[model samples]
Target chain A: MDKGRIFAYLITIIACTLYLLPLYTMVNVSLKSPEDLIWGPVAPARRLYFNSYLQAWEKISEPFFNSIKMTVPATLISTFLGSISGLGFYRAKFKYKDLLLFLIVLGFYVPPQAVLIPLVKFLADIGLYSTIAGLVLTHVAYGMPITTLLFKNYYESIPKEILDSAEVDGASLTTLYRSILLPLSLPGFAVVSIFQFTNIWNEFLFALVLGRGRASQLVTVAIANLKGTTLAAWNVQMAGAVIGAIPVAIFYIFATKLVIKGLMAGAIKG
Target chain B: MARYGNLQIFLFILPATVLVGIFVYAFSAWNVSISLTDWRGLVTSIRFVGLENYLKLINDPIAQKALINTFLLAVTFIPLTMLIGLITAILLCLELKGTSIFRTIFLLPLSFSFVISATMWTWMFSPEQGTINSLLRLLHLDFLCQPWITSTEQSLWCILLVYIWQFSGYVTIIYYSGIRSIPQEHIEAAEIDGASRFNIYRHIIVPQLKGETIGVLTILLFYALRVFDLVYLLTGGGPALSSEVLATYMYRMTFNQNLFAYGASIGTVIFIIALAIMIPFLLLSRRR
Candidate 1:
């Protein structure tokens, strides 16, 4: 009721409205036909046109599959590898430990563009270039820093006494990790998964350059290509945009808390 | 006593280390090498041309334009987004009703791909029958109706506007989390001392949120420096290279014009600039 509250409320409404504008435009554009799109503010010839959605769906389905093939395995592998390394760093004392940790952390800062050409050549030499496996490998490499950081922080938060107790029980490292560490780290896993899922789902450049063929192209590249091909069809492009964005939106809707937590953790710790 | 665990740590780290080493560090080295050579088209001949490519980059008009546009975009977007983000975060930290809903709604933009967001905005900014133009017409502000993305003068600002809209919420979530983590006792004690809300925030909260501010600013700076996706999708850095940023311009040089070495040089410059800015910020934050 006070001016402060009123001002906050007004700002909140404006911010939310600005945030929602593009989504509103996407939905409205998707509903309109090509003619309506070009005519500008004209009355729609019909309530809805399903053709654009159909076309977008048909065009992007293959790339959607390609994205899944590349993203899922890469996410799983990166999370698994990151967790193991995090546990090792936390539990085991090692020479060059600081250096290794620093190197892993440094991965977060290296610009992807810097490595694009060499990665292309490396993959090409190994006959993996333009393949889903190559795409997945590149993603995993790029993804490790944050994933390792997340798991390391999560493991650090765990009590050292628990691991000592497990050691006292004569449990081997592998057994302890499998039974105790992994189970205790489920929230961290979820957090990492959400981060990796959104990141890989939205990734564009590697998918664009590395996955050149229809066989390996991901949804982002597919949608980008659609933009080029459907230059005049605004409705179709909007439909494609909506389709390309849906998976990420769905993932965020389900795991919003975990994603936000993961992001905050990374930001704070970094 | 735990010295032998070094081997264990090495084994555990091997996969990630090797992957990053090969793809990141090694690849970066290769990118730098390629930039120094005259590699053309799909041709594999890579002959070192000393600093010729770098010299060319300094003089190339379009490359200069791209560098200017990139810095312009960063300078414009980073501070504006941070201010918006700080305000939103402060509001959310008030623990108002529906705060959870507000959190979720605000962070939703982070989940959407920049490509999709940019494409959708492009349509909304279209010259003919675009939503922006239609709205202007409705409000009898016919003078405001213009091609938002196509005009050379307006395109970069238009792109910056979209970037701000897409990222403000993301930065808000970061700041919100940061603000929440600030101990409540500080605020409460300040209040008990008869401190006004603004004074409490200014004197207490802002200083406490320094780490979060640095982290958010650094991420935004990196993003602004290397921005490509939205510009690529929205304008392809054109209506005459008006909206071109360094990354998109690099892509254009190599892919569009087959000036591979020139593009690589531009990319190398971008990397160096990013490093120069980030390393100092990181060191300063670490010192703090």
Candidate 2:
């Protein structure tokens, strides 16, 4: 009601619109006929149309499944590995432990460009090139640093006394991890798994290079290919993008709190 | 009681250590050696060229353009995103009605993959039928509509716009937390000293966000260095290679042109730049 409050509301409205416009346009065009897209991207659809979605889905279904195949294994492997490594770094006492963790985490920041050349060559040499397995390996390897960081930080907040008592109960290393750390890590698992699933599902670079052809192509690359093959069919192209984004977008919208928690945890720890 | 011996700890860490060592560090070293050669195509042969690729890269016009474009994108993008993010954070930090809704909407773009965002933005920036131009025309602001990604002059800027839209929300979250963490006593004391709301923020609030700014800048600089998906998907580094950054350009050289060694050299350049940006930041953060 007051001046400042009114000013804040006005800016909020404008910023929300700015944020949502492209998404609105994409959805609008995606529901329109090709003839309607020619009219412009801003206009709302005059008639409901599902043909573009159907066509896009039909073309992209294989790669969509491919993404799932790649993403599931990659997410599981990375999260599991990250958990163990995170636990290792947290519980282990040694000289240069901080330095070692620092080195591991530093890999998260390496530009994919820096390693693309050798990665491709190495994959070829090992005969994993152009396979979904290779793509999984690539994501798992790259996923290690961040996941480890996340789990390490997560485990750090657990009381040292809990671990000491678990040891007092005569638990060995494996039993402690199994009986104590693993159970305590369930929530961390939820956060990291969702985080890793969303990321691995949405990743493009490894999918592009390691899995190029139809047999191995990822949804992201498939969508790009759809754009190329359907240059003038804006409606269908938008449909394909929407389809490719559906899984992660759903995660973001429904599990926003978890996503935000993971993001903040990662950023703050970094 | 459950504490592992050093060897057990080593075993626990071995999988990640081996994977990262071979896949990340070892591969990086391999890439460096590849850069020093004249390897090309599907040949097993590699001739050691001893910095020839680097020398050529230093003299290459496209590489120079990429360096300049990358520099310009970073210098412009980081500050603008930070400013917008900071302002948004400040507003949302006010805890006004509907602030949560606005926060959700702002962070929504961060969920969309670069591939998806690039696809959507391509339609938004398409000159003939883009949402932006169409909206402008409908509003009788036809003169305001300009060639966006289609023009070499504007393509990079268009990409920059999309990058900001995608990332500013992330920076906002960081700054929002930073703002929230500022001690309440400081603000109350300032207000009691006859400071206006604006001065209270200017003198006490914004200065404390220095740590947040550094974090944001480091992330943004790294993003700038490794930008490929957006540029490649949105513009393909083109309108005559005008929007090319090192990543896309290196991708084109290696994959498209099959100039393996040449592309590796460019990759090394990017690696060095990343190191240059990251090493100091790491040391600084550690000191803090």
Candidate 3:
């Protein structure tokens, strides 16, 4: 290769390696037996061990199911709400329309720290405190801003003429959404669902606060608690972390373009 | 659509509007009220103190440490991530062989939750058996090894490294898209004008990324303001509260110590800071 090309390749290689190092170490350490862990982390694992994975899975199974129960409903409800709202904002003409949409989307920017104090008390007052249902409500509420924005922006791409023509055909709002917009929005739904699913699944703060204790705890909290409870069981800890991450990692790897598109759409337009 | 009347549209959007309005905005206001009180402990009675908590926070050393540490992390984390991300984006834009693979690898870290990354990083920063130190030892560079997460002076920096690792990929994807959106003709025209590749990039491509820079800055600053998970998980704002950011400090005050009013005050401060950072960016973008 030419010198300039070689230099570019060299830098890219080094950057990629830097990015991959932690992941490599996590996987490597998880596979090492306790006896092999006596050697420093730099050394390759002497043998691949599945014991840690089994133990970690056993430890986190309840929380894993709780995460699923929490995440699925949260993701589905948020995405469904976002879709209808996106269409509503898209099709409906009202005074201060842009301002109203802006205000709604502005919810995306509010830090969780801002709402956390009131959230805990409110959930408790509603008698859902420290429960998986409370966590679901929290995620669904917080997930609104981004999910709505994603759907709004996604709907914006569809030609308004579709709605115009549908209206001309005597189609009502629900009919237009069901018969026209929803059909066109399948891909958008997929992208937004994946985005919401991963976000709600990976969320920690709400899970930590509202879903405290073993019964209601989500997987992220479970993994964190695993880390805290285990002193030197790095293998189990790493294994648990990996297991918690597998679903999102698969989406990230296979649907990278969609993920990037979701990110840019949510970020730049907002 | 004529059928899309105000009520109909409102009904469609009401669920989210009401939820977010109650959960985010209303609760935020509630937090302000709580901050104005002297309600500490698990007491049901709230006695209004009217900015006393804020006033006390001005004199509180722990709060000062947290504010300074937050500023330091923001000042260090954002620019460093953006710079490295920009550089990596530029390199990947070279379209070298296996660039897609590199892109995938680079962006993979963004998928990991803070808990997972923190877990991995804590082990990596273990002073005695950490990955970095072990590598240093293997390479016969003992002098380079230092106390990482265990020391007050370096703990914040260690936390910053993990933050960079987790987020720089996000910045990279944004900047990469930004760079890709730049018209090819501009670079081609510069090339035809006898500009060296370095000069073309330095003068044209890099400078054209101003919008991306701003976007990245706003997002990074947002993360900086809301940083709880990683700091809470990794350092627990420990080593004498050296790595304490406002979020962790607020969390510790409220949950751990039950200083409800004081914690709410800290939350109010975070809320205001988030607004201060966001409004200008919003206005600037709106004008654009």
Candidate 4:
């Protein structure tokens, strides 16, 4: 290999290692008991310690389940809505369709700060305030734009001839959707739902403001509360952080390609 | 044919359209009207006050500081992330073995929640019991140890470093994909013309990434403008409000203090800034 290839290799490796330090710190510190803390985060732990994980689990396990209760329903509902909405834009052309499409997509662009106050008020007015159902609704509502956009983009990629031929056979709309588009959309649902899962799982502000009660608190909020103590709590906090992160991290381990596709879908089109 | 105004198509989109209309667009409109009021506290005193809250924000010292901090954070992190991302992309595209693993390692941070990152980064940036200062001491450079997030001078920069750490990987992957999508013939032609690897990158590869650059910059802009979780969690906009940005300030004002009108005003500022950043992206995507 030439000097250039060698230089490139060196730079990439060095950058990757340096970028990984904080994560390495999380895992390393989590595995260390208080007695091992003297090594000061750089040295390997004295032994494999599971105490902190157990301790952290005791505190965060409730919110961990809360996160699941919120995320699973929200992901399923939003991705389902996005599919039908996206397919709406896909199959048929209509007047003001672009305008409506633009409006929905525009929703995805606005900062969450823009709508926070009214959302709180509106949710309370409807009596769903500070509830997991409220969070699920908020996520689904906000999720429409991207989910719709993704499904639209996904459906658009399928050749127009397939749809035309199906229509020519006098197939009804339900048949066209159920028999043809539904089968083709499994991968699309995977990509969209994974995107929504990671996003809602990681979402902070909405949960912070809307899901303030312990009954509805998310793991992100729970983990954040763990961050209050500075030194003595490091081990447990890191463990909580690791546990809270594991759900999406599992996707990274197993379905990295889908994760990448979800991330890049909008970017490439834009 | 699946004709326009087909009852089925309209039915399919109704729920999403209604939800988006009410939650996203209408609430945004309500937020704007609230910004024009004197609404504060629990009781609904939606008295019209024009833009007084907005005008008050102009003289609000904390708001001023937050604006400057947000500007500094954006202007610093976005370009730095882009430059780092571009360089990393180029390096990874050098036909190296195990490049996929490198890509995963680089992009792993993107999968982490901001809260998780906030936790890890806070530990790393803690002044006394932190890894960074610990490393400095282990290097026998104990004198160089500094109060990281605890020091106002270093707090924003600490957040900036973490921001770059979190988002640059995503940018790198985008740029890598952009590089891969660049047609090979251009690079080959440049090589045939005696272009060195450096010259080929400088001349052929980077120039063709205009779309990716636009996309990456806008995405980074969106993140920069809304970067609250890390700063709020790590420093809590602390050490004298030095690292406070618009999002944190907005949250504190609206949620913590119940200054609904004032918070809405700040939210309006955020919305405007978002529109400013988004319109170009919108127009560009439309054109394409």
True contacts kept of each: 0.54, 0.68, 0.72, 0.69
| Tens-digit lDDT track of model 3 for B1-288 | 365567888888888789888988899999999899988886878788898999999999999999999989988999899988888888778888898888888889889989989988887888899888988898899999989989999999999998898888888888898889999999999999999988988999888988777778767876887888998999899999999999999999998999989999999998898888777777787676
Ranking by DockQ: 3, 2, 4, 1
Clashing residue pairs found in predicted model 3: none
lDDT minimum window of 10 residues, candidate 1 chain A: A37-46
Q: What is the lDDT of residue B124 in candidate 3?
A: 85
Q: Model 1: per-residue lDDT, tens digit, B224-286? A: 866888888888898898988888887778767887777778778877887787767766777
Error of 4 at A186 (Å): 1.5
The better-scoring model by lDDT among 2 and 3 is 2
Candidate 3 stretches with Cα past 4 Å from truth are none
Query: Candidate 4 — which pairs collide?
Result: none
Residue clash pairs of candidate 1: A40-B129
The TM-score values for the models, in the order shown, are 0.93, 0.97, 0.97, 0.96
CAPRI verdict (incorrect, acceptable, medium, high) for model 4: medium
Q: Tell how far residue A219 is off in model 1, in angstroms.
A: 1.0
What's the DockQ of model 3?
0.73
Q: Name the better of 1 and 2 by lDDT.
A: 2
Worst 10 residues of 4 chain A by lDDT: A261-270
Give the winner by DockQ.
Answer: 3
For each candidate, how many residue pairs have backbone atoms clashing (under 3 Å)?
1, 1, 0, 0
